[model samples]
Target: MSTTTAPASATVADAGYGSARRRDPVLIGLWISLVLVAVVWIAPFVFIVFTSLKTTGDVMTTGAFTPPATVHYQNYENAWARGDFSTTFTNSVIITFIKVPLGLFISAMAAYALARMRIIWGKLILLIILFGTMIPFQVMLAPIFTVVNSFGLIDTYPGIILPYLAFGVPYQVFILHGFFSVIPRELSEAARIDGASDITIFRRIFLPASIPVLAALLILDFVNTWNEFAMALVILQDAGMWTLPLGLMSFQGQFSNDYGQLNAAIVMTVLPATIVYLIFQRYFVSGLMSGAVKG
Candidate 1:
């Protein structure tokens, strides 16, 4: 009996070892796939940086992969000076700054009321907002243009900003509604028992807890507004009022295109938001997961 038990124990130990050995190749394959994905994702940005540093002659002569014989930092300098990006950058910043906070606050308030406060037609209101998400921007463009033109908002910052806010609010509201719904009712009830007003509860308790969702929403809204081109193109006729996307369009001439300068400008345009995402990536991920899981 003892000899039979010893062989059985040895076989079990060997089986466990074999299982671990099999998992090793799976882990290795997963890691290799991840590395490949990372390289593919990063390669374009790397090429852009290298191309931006190359001279027009070098860019036209050698492929972007070839290391520059001498780095020409002048491409960036020329692009910055010649491209009128200063105004473009400022316009984007202003639009983003105004839109994000306003959108978040309004959306949060609407979401809170919709989710927490039992009101008539609450479900209908939510349905309407959700339905609006399905409507394509292109469909509304003509009507939006006529309205903006009537208000004399065309060629003005408000023209661009108001539309962005209007369209962005519904999506923000939808996301925040899901988040607000998941907040423990007990917490809000406790606040009320302590004589806190709804506004006070929202500001003190809900807002603080909802920071991650807010951060994620803010990042999404900012990126969307920053990269918006078609609306800006149609609405904004003034060159000085152009955003980065519109400004980049000028790089493509009727007869010729400045690929080097265009690449440089593109790099500059993307850098700020890229840096922002890198910095807040942790919060963004956490916020998204929290909202998704809790909702």
Candidate 2:
């Protein structure tokens, strides 16, 4: 009887092992696919870095995939100097600094009111704001230009910053509205019971709790303002006011199509945002996940 029971247990164990073996192929295949996709995505970035480090002749002759015999560190220096990137970098930083904080503050405040207030036309107000997002930016460009020019804002920092704020507000409001809606009403009520004013309640309760959403918004707004070229190009006509993207374009033209210098300029332009994302990667992921879960 003992011998018979041992054989039956061995048979059960063999069946379980067989089942796991069958599933292993599928799991292995999925892992391989993910790795391949990552490699494909990373390949272009690697190529760009290599191109940025090559000499002009090497960049033109060796192709983007080929490694140069000696890495040319001077390409970066030349690109920075020739592009006048220092001034352009300052301009970009100034615009981003103003745009991000103002955009987030206004949007968050508006969203809070829309989400928490018991106004009769709350849905209609939200609808209008959401509708603004659907309007193509190109359609508003002419009107915006006319308005900015009329205000004597054209070719000025305020000119570009004003339009960016207007365009960015709708999306910012939309995102913050969603976040504000899901925050517990009890928290606000508790603050009110403690004799806190509306502003205090927002500052002490909502703002602290909404950090994940705010962090996500900050990253989004920064990247958008940093990479914005079209509005900057149209609004800032002076070379002195050019941002990094426009400055890089000017640098390319000045270099007589030097590929190494162009690539180097591109790398410089990309580096700040890349570093920012890397530094905040964990917070970004957390924010995104938190927003998704709450939504």
Candidate 3:
């Protein structure tokens, strides 16, 4: 009797070939979708960057999407000088740094209380907190302005930050509460059994575990604070105290005829937030799942 068998290498190769062929359609579809999405997402940024390099005449004659015949580097210089970006940018940085961490700390503590501690009317308090997220920004504008004016805080950093904190805290509390809810109660109990205080457990365990979510929130809050125009406009009447957004609005009138310089200002306005996002992008994906819970 005789038997024939395929060689080991041949068998392995055939299996791999078959698997790849079976997956070919899915892989091709995935690649196509990614390419399409990338092009769509990048299109506006490309348009802005290209438009920013064209003179006003180039912009008008060459059409919106057309590349400039001659690159204009002076647009950036003109934008920075005319927009007063240096001072406005510094103002934004100070405000964002002050508010984001303060908001996060307050939110995290509020979340810990709601998720971990037993208190009278805790659920009622949480409902009120969650309800704050639903209120429209416009609706709060008058009240906030009134409160700030009554306290004589207008044109000051505190005037801007206090209202921002009030508007921003509810959302942070909502998210942080959801995340803290998923953290098993047993972990806190175990720490308590070992004589760890509530603050100790929070600082040593919860905060360390929550770094990814906190980092994600840090970037979001930073962007929001940086780009915030309405509140800044309402609170900061003094030109010297204006943030980037307010500066941009006022500067837009100066560059009305110069689209290149206008777009250059836009780029500079968006650049810091973009840089912050790129720096913290790794944590963003994992932190997105922070509020999910067990079935």
Candidate 1 per-residue lDDT over residues 184-271, each given as its tens digit: 9999999999999999988998889999988898888878888898888888889988998887777544213565676788899998
The 10 consecutive residues of candidate 3 with the worst lDDT sum are 1-10
Q: Name the better of 1 and 3 by TM-score.
A: 1
2 against 3, candidate with superior TM-score? 2
Question: Evaluated with TM-score, which candidate comes out highest?
Answer: 1
* lDDT-sorted candidate list, best first: 3, 2, 1
RMSD of 2: 3.0
User: Can you give the TM-score per candidate against the true fold?
Assistant: 0.91, 0.89, 0.88
Tell me which residue pairs clash in candidate 2: none
RMSD (CA, angstroms), candidate 1: 2.8
lDDT of 3 by residue, 1-295 (tens): 1233457667899999999999999999999999999999998998889989998888888877777889998999989998898999889989998999999999999988888898899999999998988998877788889999999999999999988898888888887778888888889999999999989999988898888888888888989999999888888999999999999888898777788999999999999999999999999878757754422
Comparing 1 and 2 on TM-score, the stronger one: 1
Report, for all candidates in order, the number of backbone clashes. Answer: 0, 0, 0
Which regions in candidate 3 have their CA more than 4 angstroms from the true location? 1-23, 60-71
